[model samples]
Target chain A: MTGINTPSARHRRRTGRLDWIWFVPFFGFTLLFLVIPTIGLIIGSLTGGHPRVTLKYLAQLSQPQFLDAYRTSIALSAATALGAGLVGILLAWAAIGGGLPKALRPLLMTFSGVASNFAGIPLAFAFTASLGPVGMITVLLQQATGYNLYHHGFSLFNFWGLAITYLYFQIPLMVLLITPALETLGRWSEAAASLGASRWQYWTRVALPILRIPLAGALLVLFGNSFGAYATAYALTSGMINLIPILIGQEMTGNVLFSPGLGDALAVGMVVVMSVVFGLYLLMNRKGGRWAQ
Target chain B: MRPARGSSWLVVLLGAAYFILPLVATLQFSLQTGTRPLFSAYSSILTASGFWASLGLSLFMALAAVAIGLLLIIPAAYWAYLRAPKVRTWVEFLSILPFVVPPIVLVFGMVGLYGNGFGPLSSPMVLILAAYGVISMPYLFRSIDNGLRSVDLRTLTQAALSLGAGWPVILLRIVLPNLRTAILGGAFLVFALIMGEYAISSMLGFNTFGVYMLLTGQTRAHAAAALALISFALVWVFVGFMHAVNRGNITFGPGAR
Candidate 1:
């Protein structure tokens, strides 16, 4: 059956005309919006008012506040990724390990899907409405135990509070990305286990090697996703919390020190952070693609 | 080798409880109707003009953004998949650039470029551009790429060409039908995103659904809760619709891509 169909007869020859017409609108929109805005941001960072090129804006990175913001952002991103990824892997293992009932699989999957995509300001509102001073849970807890979490400094405006809120979405995203990888493991692992292999040995010898690359790649994507996030933190703390995205926003809005050049330089810093993360993601993805093949 | 089922149920229950706790609280707050410090905020927000206008504006913006996104993405994606596969990654990366860039940064950039006498900063059109361009990236790129992966574009083009069908006809008749489910799923996801987006709209001086919640929360806390409830419900519905479409596609196997 395979020998009957050959590539020689039906394949059409290339015209080599290089169809340029189709690319015009696509490239035009990309260049105008994305390329131009980014360039403007970069140039804006390089020069202050009146458009004279200078390096004064770049030197603002030496400021303590900017440095603190950068450190906090990196730390938060790393912690979130690590926590979410580990939990996600565990959840995937449980769900796809034949440990859960058949009927519950779909329900769990749907819930995880919704929760994974569920973040940003609404999530913040949800958490605050439940845990704030006048919040429902807060009121209930106080009435029952004469103890208010808020009075004990459980404010959602702080760094730890923000991290908890961020986890509302991060955990689910990790589960969603990792579940498919688990599903692909199928009955092979079980068959190996039945053949006298211990659980740890089976996973180490078979599954871990196969899944490590994709897991690493997913972790990179999650790290980048949290690192670049702005809305959730912005809405929760009103940009009071010193995060890079918040600082960038403050600078852009002229709320900070009035230096368009400095704001642009801060934006350049943001671009640099995103580029490094994205570069890591691309590298991991390339490795993952090879592994998948 | 079978594990006990009760542990699984416990895990599922714990997960559900964690996910639903905040939502249940929000709903309770939204439903309160008293006038004192705790209760009357919901009723007031429900009767407010700003609430209604913001809701309408948010819906309008979301719909417009989705429509514009579809129009732009369909053609661009089709062209990339069919003619210039080499540039596909770069094009996709560009499309999602706004998303990867901080929202505040993008909003500030927009203000710098178009605010004041230069152009329309506070205009709804600018919000639409930002929302559509940023949020639509994942949807457009994923759906279109999946659709392309599912079919043989070269063979379809050749077959259509031999039968005297033009490029437009082939695209509309042959390509689109296969991509319908993916497009629908993507659109729904984009719609949900725009519905929840707050930073861009709020920063740019527009009153989106999220902004309504923030604004109302300042004075009428319950009203803010009500707004949050409404926003949550809307997003829930959109997510449900996306899941349904995806499930249906999976069942038939036509939309698996």
Candidate 2:
């Protein structure tokens, strides 16, 4: 050990060796649990019950049934992401820059933290109780203003209904993620104002360009978040709808024509879509982060 | 300024209303029993065997997942910060991979790999916990790493080393104590996430709290509402507790004012 005393080799054998060892557990566990499962998914998707690698299932993704599911899910995610982003940015802007009471900020944040994490069946139930058919608000509005929510085709089981339910978490999530970015906007706006730009001009020209990448990133996040959502949609529609997650769940659980391999294909398809969106999000975030510096 | 202030109030009010309305409605619905206000739903859920059993299972799972996450994340994050800076990026990416991979997709992979009806991954508890650990990794890593970021790790490690303390002593006595708030924050988030998690457990055929809620939702409306509110309360408790722990200690960066 003493004879092999080159500086680089010593450094490598001493500190670098132990340092790399620290990563083993994290990477090993991740590889065992996360990476293997993902590889399983990919292999499972490409292969079939025969376990021989084939592109048959990958080709299944383009079928009308599967394509329709993807379409509905994408549409739902896009609507919710866009809706949540606009409203969340508004809410965050109001909370940060709005001339409201100073005490409200912390309260808003605590609530957002709670609400953003508040998902699954309970959240779906909350929305159903409020806006579902025969719900309190639905009944109240019907009796008070002759606005029959159900009769008017506002069922809480369709794409729009699911999108609204998603906003319960999404809007707050948007608020939480976008708030820090919003905090950095103040000095930029003041600088613009000092340059004799009007408020609208400051927003449209200065603020918009600066915030573009981050906002787009946030919306893409919102998109991916909703796109991957399964439980809420499943609980709300009970697999009546053909969303991709529901379809995968249905196939996985053998509720309808169990094909484990096809389920894998659907899952693989979802990962591809989510990965593309997430890649865009990361790209935008990198650009935004660079701009911030 | 006046108009901006007015619109701000309006926006905040409307956002608050959107958030609070469902909760209020659910509470009212849970209290209702055949046209009379009552605690029947609450009592029924409290006495239900499945509810308790599932809730207990979920609690155990959440704890186990948090422990596993802490064991894996704290050391990795600490080491990355101190000596292995290159590993940090990979850890961060893997931790957040759960966000990209839907729960259903992960479950599909699990079923594909381990649905063989034998082995460690065959057990619902082991499989769900492993999956839960992965799902909770992002939150746990983010919170703890954020906390670690607020501490001067290099200086502290060097200080502890120069004081004649070993690595274990430095980590256990010096680093862990300083990271109390971060650990608690991460643990709380992990707990909240595990308790509310539905997709993995439900898909894996486990009777966790979230699964029980979904099952109860189909047949029992008021009971489901009560359980929903209870779940919301559980999350609030965790968030509130974390908020309290992080109240004055919210550091934006190392030595940041």
- Top candidate (DockQ): 2
Query: When superposed on Cα atoms, how far off is each prediction in RMSD?
Result: 4.9, 4.2
Q: Which candidate number would show the highest TM-score if scored against the true structure? A: 2
Clashing pairs in 2: none
Error of 1 at A81 (Å): 2.1
Which segments of candidate 1 are over 4 A away from where they belong? A1-18, A49-52, B1-7, B35-47, B114-124, B127-131, B248-257
Weakest 10 consecutive residues, lDDT, candidate 2 chain A?
A3-12
| Candidate 2 A-chain TM-score | 0.92
lDDT, model 2: 0.82
Q: Please report how far candidate 2 places residue A255 from its true position, in Å.
A: 0.5
Candidate 1, B1-257: lDDT as tens digits: 32246655565566667678888998887766664655466567767888788878877877776676666666777767766787676667766565456556666665665565645544646644754565566566676667667777667866776776765787799888877777777777777777777767766667777777776666766677766667767767776777787662221000000
